[model samples]
Target: MQKPKYKRVVLKLSGEALAGDQGYGISHEIINSIAKQVVEVVKLGVEVAIVVGGGNIWRGVAGSARGMDRATADYMGMLATVINALALQDALEKLGIETRVMSAIEMKEIAEPYIRRRAIRHLEKGRVVIFAAGTGNPYFSTDTAAALRSAEIEAEVILMAKKVDGVYDSDPLKNPNAKKFTDLEYIEVLNKGLGVMDSTATSLCMDNKIPIIVFDLTKNGNILRAVMGEEIGTYVGR
Candidate 1:
């Protein structure tokens, strides 16, 4: 019954979040949970777009470290994102939410090629659009993809769904004394090397004046809370 603070938002989901506790591969339960949450927001009349990562299935950096060609490994990582996108589409459709999977790389059989106008049109029609394949280029991250998409779509904010509740001064799991920040400026995030996102992605958001909410996706109702403007996670912006 409550109104959402952001009518249009881009959700950046990490591959590890989809993997759930197993830390590898997709988890049906996790995917379903995310789908349900997204449905709830859609019902509230929010336009949603998602950019999913592929760290669970593959990591380009890791592969390159093991002697694989950087670009080849990155392409593999992009494929991994497509896999997660299809999985998410399946879950959302099963829940009666019309969803479209748009890929950066051409995969005509399975997904529509990424078109900026078509993506916006889907959102205007109340359909959720899931963006996969990491910008169709290597040496770029899904974070950057999210930033780029959010800017393109004119989204009000970015919901950065992560396993951790928020940005911390240190790794909270490793150091109990780590400080939790409720708010941060983009320059602070970058200058401190806080790692909320890659510098390029963070800079993109900063230049565009787009806000990002980094919250724990594993927490029940957190997605909804973030969209509704409830104080739940680290808010990063100008």
Candidate 2:
């Protein structure tokens, strides 16, 4: 029995990761598998807060580029995150994992309004909290939201779960010679335009002195491995 490295963590799940092999929409198999992994982490006494993205359903940036109103498109993207949050909540609850869906947009019937105190309280009580709706505003990505919420809740680190195993100089799929980086500094990520996170999110993490671990979540038990400080991903810090 190894000790968990962090008592609390934020798990950032990109919308594409939830879509799995289908490339679009929530893949039940994948979501269920993710849910199981989350449950395993919870059983380890690690508090989990998740920030989900909505790229699989709709990308606001793409819509705006196509001539739609930027704010309107971004709001639509926020709605998509809520959908992902609810779907994930359902999956977790099926496995009897206590979960809460806090929406920034404040749909009283479907979710509770985002409250900093309440969210922390949920985590304190051992409940998994899923942040939805992308900060309730446009122009701010879920990546920023993850950083924002992690700072607000004082999470030890952010588990940036992606399809890729680790950070690379280029897209590993397209370039056989791409170099993998096991560790990176916050300044390097910003100056080099690394894909670890948006500048705003990266800055927030750096400011808050929060570390981030980017790894491939599709691989089973990677979350636990990360929690145990097994070094399965690229570590980013000051």
Candidate 3:
């Protein structure tokens, strides 16, 4: 029984991660697997909050078409996050872990509206809260949402779970010679224009001095490892 490095952490998961290998839509197996890991961390006395992206269902910029308005497209992207949140909620509850889905956009029928104090209360009560809808506005990615929520929740760290194992000097898939960085300072990420996260998200984390651990969530039990500070990924922070 190892002690967790972070007592309260925010996990930023892309919607595609929920799809498993299918690359789209929620996979029950993947969802259940993720829920299990979350439960493991919670059992360790870590207060966890999640911010999920909607790339699996839609990307606002990509959705923009010759006829589609940018705002409408972004709204649709927000809706996609809501869908991911609901699916994650189902999976978590099925595992007998208490969870709450809080969206920036008010949709009382589906989830509680985002309120900083209320969300904090949920975390204090040991319930995992999933934040969806991308800041409740357009021209923002869920990455920014994750950063914002991490600051609001006063989380110890942001677990940035991606498809890639770690941050690379170049696209690892395309360049065999690309170097992988095990640790990076906040400025290095911003100075190099690293694609680890959007500039807005990166800037926010740097400003708040919040550490981010980027790793592949597809790896089983990675979440628990990260909370325990097992050195499994690229850590970017002060």
Task: For candidate 2, give the lDDT of residue 21.
Answer: 90
**Which portions of model 3 show Cα errors greater than 4 Å?**
65-67
**Model 1 pairs whose backbones collide:** none
Candidate 3 C-alpha error for residue 67, in Å: 5.1
User: Each prediction's Cα lDDT score?
Assistant: 0.96, 0.95, 0.92
CA shift of 44, model 1, Å: 0.4
True lDDT of residue 150, candidate 1: 94
How far in Å is the alpha carbon of 52 misplaced in model 3?
0.5
**Which residue pairs clash in candidate 2?**
none
**TM-score, candidate number 3:** 0.97
Candidate 1 lDDT for residue 227: 94
Worst 10 residues of 2 by lDDT: 224-233
lDDT by residue (168-208, candidate 1, tens digit) is 99999999999999999999999999999999999999999
**Candidate scoring better on lDDT of 2 and 3:** 2
For candidate 3, write residues 141-161 as lDDT tens digits: 899999999999899999999
